[model samples]
Target chain A: MEVYHLYSGGKDSSLAAYILRKIGYEVKLVTINFGVLDSWKYAKETAEILGFPHEVVFLDREILEKAADMCIKDGHPTNAIQFIHEKALEEVAKLEGVERISDGTRRDDRVPLLDQRKTRSLEDRFNVQYIRPLLGLGYKTIRELTERLFIVEVKESEKLEKSDYEVELRHLLRERGIDPLTIFPKKHLQSRVIGWKKEKAHL
Target chain B: MEVYHLYSGGKDSSLAAYILRKIGYEVKLVTINFGVLDSWKYAKETAEILGFPHEVVFLDREILEKAADMCIKDGHPTNAIQFIHEKALEEVAKLEGVERISDGTRRDDRVPLLDQRKTRSLEDRFNVQYIRPLLGLGYKTIRELTERLFIVEVKESEKLEKSDYEVELRHLLRERGIDPLTIFPKKHLQSRVIGWKKEKAHL
Candidate 1:
């Protein structure tokens, strides 16, 4: 079975892709470029290093603006990020032979989360399986897995250019003379997968 | 208002007592000695160093045995620790002029947690307020506060003789020819508050 995985080149997404491949499922890495500066660069590099087929889907710039506007209106980025995530999933589900869509949503991830109702609706509407392989795992487990599987570079979320949709949304809001801090919490941490190393064969 | 705090001479309890004092409450430190070896020794030293009036209550050795037995039967220590905690609170609430009881439970503490129903029942039955000053704070916040307020010595829970209820329960179970690892999960990290140096007065 081939799974369309939402790839951001971050630790969670890369680990999710690796898990799928290890379990004998073909993975198609899809990165959505929402007109953010230097966003898809890391994803391309990571896919090459991991030796997986990758695709970059260009999204309309207005979609990011809409999400940022929602963040500004609500005084929080939760609803905005969820909107962008659902939009990415909707776009990925349209690809041919893509019956299963997967992402790196973890148990502790608050934003960009598809709740039970949203998950059910997406599966029913698209007639596809929406899977989150890391959903049962927490941040500690994800970090351990990433460390064991790949060489990673971790930094504050604000410092990472090639991150999740929130980064692009923050940049867009700032360009429009809005303070991103007003819509986002401070001091969040994120990771980037730089490369991979072969481990001892245990099987 | 006078509040009776359950003091274990650990990081969480010491920080909890300090927070209550900073917020202008007359705090009374109460340590329960359940016949565990060296359990009340650190609590005595910590209370003297912090310049708080402290009381040590002697609990029957059977209490620790009961909790240990519960752990052995259930294959976990969560229920056993909670039972001991409630019993300690009930005993402290009977003290003269003690209208409120508190502990150092932080947001990240999974064990020794009193669910909402149990908390409400304790308050209603005893007609005393049950408070956890560090309830809203996470582990990082608690550690930061402890660092700012006092010099601390930290060790693993298993390494320290003066620790939480689980330590004594494990000892009791082991003495009775039962392996504690069969009941308690491994590699759990807990800290003991050993010795403190006075910081510059900020108030």
Candidate 2:
């Protein structure tokens, strides 16, 4: 069966794709572009390096603004990001032949998490399965997997030119004269997969 | 500046050595041979492949017998394995110029665990540091590192002709008319580092 993987070109997403492919699944990389600048470039490059069939889906810019407003009202981005993730999953589930959806949500991930209730609701509503291959792993394991599988460039999320939905939301909030620090936490790490190498050497 | 590593020729130990080397430590691989068959061979071979200074310390057979007896009396090998491990550490600590000791005890490992109390006591007694480079890592990470770093041969602990201290203890127990099944759990997995290739890729 085919699995639609939500990939962001980050270490977690790349490793998640590697895992799905390793387990004998046909993986199609799906990147949701929220009309953000440079958001889709790294993911597209990563998909090419990994040699996976890839697609980019565009979401309305207003969705990101809505998410930012919700974060401002709630004083946290947890629920807002979760809502965006749910919408993305809903959109992807509608695609033909996408019987399953997967992401690289590890055990320690906080934001963009689809809660159990929402996960169940999505499964019931869409008749599609949701899989998180890296859920059993943690940050250390994910980093190690990335180190072994690819040549990645890691930096603080705030410093990266390539952006995710959260980054786009932060930009939108700033553009509206709102300081993103008032809504978002500080010091998160992300990576871009530049290339890969074959497994070699003992020790 | 110099660290003595407990080398078992398994994935964890090899990765521990790799981490130590990566961090600019002078690594010395110390293998304890408790007069068990094939206990030291793989370790010796791995040290050669990794091009590190190595030593095999001959432990008295009586130590294995005592550990096995303790397991039989306690109905579990946890304490017995801990005892042997402590002894191994004490012996390695006595080596000249060895200012630190390290192991490949990962976050998910249950067996051969050194509790906080024991760890503090060892440090206080030896006046040396103890490090577990893989302590923050889990099995998934270790396995991925091994797959990338070496060509390995994995088998069930029981089926492998190469033996560790625990295997020797089981054999000793069986010879004394005690079924190891009663004392040891089933389905333990271990691997031998048969060979290695130079790391060719950046990841």
Candidate 3:
């Protein structure tokens, strides 16, 4: 069975591919790179290091323009680009009866969807299998797996550029104590007030 | 130092608390039970077994119902309910001054934000440290740890309701010989095209 992993060449995706390969499956790596970034910064390089066939789906100006339009028209969140990647996955899923397109998203991410929401019914439509090898995994094991495999470490080249949103947000929310996961748009606050003061506070 | 673990009562979460206690931290267990789901199915039972203070935040009918409505109205696939759970964590973050909110979401869950879709900023806003003890850990190790602690086995649980849409779609799509994660509500196909088509195909 041929499986395509949504590769990103980072600790998570790299570890995910390692585990899938170890489980005795012919795996191919695929990464949807945004034009602004190195696109294949980590994903392609790692796929090369692992000696696996890799595909890079470049997000051209048209793709970015459409994304910006979606965000503006639908009031999509600033990070709604995942939906685009999901769309790219569909293009890949149509490969010669390819049955499954896998990803590295693990159980530990605990991240919310773009627009501060979660994808509900997007899956049934795609008509492909999204396998997350690390769904039930923990961070500690992934680190150990990386260490064991001697997969290329998170080198300067593999890391996200300073402009990468993941890197930017990680710094803001994680290091700066912003807690983006809990913060929401104006509308979210007007509704259910969790621990907020009735009027003065914004979520 | 005060720390809170997002407990789902799953073995992974159970081990998180167990490991933390072993290391000796004043740990508080917070369980989020979306009202739409069987909130305390295995989680509550698991928490009872371990003797940890379990605080469950239910997504009131108002919350999830409204979220489902927004999804339909906007033609966007989203789960606002999960955001509420994140919001609840912020409350916990504030109440306990918990510098960190650790979860069972592992390393593969690197897609903390939608690739190009949206962003979750709550984790940053609250200054709450979000830690995934298992981020580097694997499922096999998790199973081993559960057994080592004499916790309930995975085999005992007949059904585990998931929180992520991609995983749920994976199951449904796999059942129908497709990959759900691919069509992750990308603009290529509207909900009518994907959701109804899959539903029709299923029947």
Candidate 4:
């Protein structure tokens, strides 16, 4: 009854972990690291704040490089981010004792999204349950829940420091003398769950 | 926050109510009664065993009649059941102080299924959140979770005395001199959650 949730140190994934635990699953927050930077540490810190055991799974560095190339070629990050996400899920699915894997992808998410067909295929191949607790909840409901349950810090996507795949992808572009801002979209605000509203912890 | 879950005394909806409560929502199980039969009482009893408040919302008898007519004409119960399910949700959505509504429709449900567009429309029109916690879980995962968490009785569809919409629909057809077996598919097994597995209740 343990589910390894893909953690990004953000409100949505944090909430997914919370809901999974509430519904009787032991949640282990996992951040996939690809050697691009120590980004997973940020997620580890947030996981500690949320009071869940945290782990860093090492994905092939080549995968991040390929995603970076795709981002640079398309000047958009959607496809590349989605690529990394699927790879991360596959890695988790292959882990021992990991019969259930989950992510925070919501109904309104455009990037890093797994459609039902892909989800089913993963479940069938790995004999694991791929749970997306937020898939049925829309933007309005998610915002309302997070506002009540989490202490979040919102900043421009470029300035925000978190363990989501985007952080490493952006760094890869920078290493290759490319400004991530050019390939990555502008004016996007990202949120990081710094802590919980302690009063609502028991609820 | 409180959610009015469409309860049928079946494992799916019962689990939905349990999950909603575990996630910090006060759940009130609402069984929509069209007065075709007193089937809602069955759901009320199960809700009592699960330790949640229960209420019966009466819908227009005309709606059930219309669904029965559809069943007789088509010689199949799919469209008829879907019609009644939609009507039931509408009745719940229109209730005063009902800001959130939920159902047990799972990933593989065909009849009475609400596609994203239809769900969004209901939410927009009613100004309420339509929650479906089981929509992302496929048959295997759901069966596993229910077996672990609930004490359920499995019986042939016709013999199962539960509060699901199909029960009332069958009664309506029978009242109109139809065998109900002629229009409803056979050999389908239905489940009723008689109680929770006491040892796993808190989890």
Best by TM-score: 4
B125-192: candidate 2 lDDT, tens digit per residue: 88777776665444544565567777788888777645356777888888899988898777777787
DockQ of 3: 0.03
In model 2, which runs have C-alpha deviations exceeding 4 angstroms? A1-203, B36-38, B197-203
DockQ of each: 0.02, 0.04, 0.03, 0.65
Candidate 4: docking tier = medium
Clashes (backbone N, CA, C under 3 Å), per candidate, total: 0, 2, 65, 0
As a TM-score, model 2 comes out at 0.51
Which sequence of candidate numbers ranks them by DockQ, best first?
4, 2, 3, 1
Q: Report the Cα RMSD per candidate.
A: 17.0, 8.8, 17.8, 1.6
What TM-score quantifies how close candidate 4 is to the native fold? 0.96
Candidate 2: tens digits of C-alpha lDDT, residues A1-203: 58898888877887777766653468899988787665787788778877889888888777787888898899878878887887888999988767788887765677677655676677778877776766544454456556767887878777765435677877888888988778877776667877775642111
Report clash pairs, candidate 4: none
> How close is every model to the real structure, measured as TM-score?
0.49, 0.51, 0.37, 0.96
Descending-TM-score candidate ranking: 4, 2, 1, 3
How far residue B117's Cα lies from its native spot in candidate 2, in Å, is 3.0
